[model samples]
Target: MSDDPKTLVSTDWLANHLKDPDLRVLDASWYLPDAGRDARAEYHAAHVPGARFFDIDEISDARSDLPHMAPPVEKFMSRMRRMGVGDGHQIVVYDGAGLLSAPRVWWLFKLMGHRDVAVLDGGFPKWQAEGRPTEDLAPVVKDRHLTVRYQNQLVRDVTQVSQASKLGTTQIVDARAAARFRGDAPEPREGLRAGHIPGARNVPFNTLLNTDQTMKSPDQLRTVFEGAGVDLSAPVITSCGSGITAAILGLALERIGHDRWSLYDGSWAEWGMFPTVPVATGDA
Candidate 1:
């Protein structure tokens, strides 16, 4: 509906195009450990009609110690092929928690060089609230070959983030809350230090969303980023707790037409665990 089918889509757009042969809906629900909800169980209980479950954790780079690193090209291709999603298909990923976690999957599709993927604006909760159709049945699947280009430019490692932080050439935006960014609140994940990357600005992922959990308008999103001292002209590198919510920032940047951006995949999870990287605290 916003004319960017590769970034986001309204619930109305999805509902109207639900029966399209080339449309592939994915239930990509994931919750933080403390949230106490099982994503798989919930998907099995209810999901958008003809939607397939996309397990974020299971379909990732398991070799990495960090939580749910982006899956390798082969893994992504295999998983998507197994789900009957392939070239020429329009992907719409959604989560149980409105805007949460869905963007991660959307980003993944992009990183894997799939341009037709998009996140369901407002996700499952909003769809249900609007009285849209949902079903407990799993859709039939047929294998479809998937080709991945693997866009390395869309992801950043810890070393790259550290370099960017020290150089100040790029804007390092943290998606964690102000409290977490300032070390005023404890991290939800264990054994990680508080505070944020040096010179990084805080723009909590929630600040980019409206009350219904849909992303704010492009102009409003620009205002939110500018208010946080992010320079729109500079390239941006977004980071968050374990790189999950960071994709929310990435999506926001994409919505605002900021094409020169990447997600710090390691984020605070790796930076906070390492002794070599510097961490800054407070609102300075």
Candidate 2:
């Protein structure tokens, strides 16, 4: 494995660097409806000092019927600006459940042309459980000017993903749970198909993460992916429920020296809705 860029930092590293002037911390936590937890409410209760809540649902492609399609470049810029995230900021994102939603935010930053970002391993829960400093206080808001330089290469659309399935040029990896990928479980979103793409492989997002919410070692990540029949030499496009967990797959790919991977931003939310799109049921 190559010495990959430090796309991840430990909770200790974050605690030591919390007060760094250039570091901007974000609490990018969201939960499914069944979880019965409001991310905003939890953020208000207690969070890393100076951390801001990143709402996945709100900062999305508002016009698309698809759930959480990537927002337009202008909307993304506007949202980050309002959240005080500007150009040249070294962003560190963390979620309540460690590595979950944090990678999604990191992918967002990368898509917007910001690469100086990392996810906090072992996230807020780990920090709190370890008795690191936290507060119920929200940071004072300051407007920051973020330079908008969208990177189209890091993102793929429904059409591109569909074509990729036909051409078999890029390896399609679905990060959804195995049951969903195999059509054994109903989709979380009502009315969507339960199976995966015609030529996709299932690698559940949880497998990429440890019990503590940190990513596995590089060798382990490579093994996990290789077990799913994903060849790192080929181009990769990751998808999952609405594109959230798919970012985790992208992160894993990046960690394993495969930098030429992109995410299906609309993901199954769009593809599963199209009746004519091909879907494969049952495991390989």
lDDT of each: 0.93, 0.87
The per-prediction CA RMSD against the true structure, in angstroms, equals 0.9, 1.7
- What residue pairs are clashing in model 2? none
lDDT score of model 2? 0.87
Clashing pairs in 1: none
Model 2 residue 154 CA deviation (Å) reads 0.9
User: Model 1, residue 141: displacement in angstroms?
Assistant: 0.6
TM-score of each: 0.98, 0.96
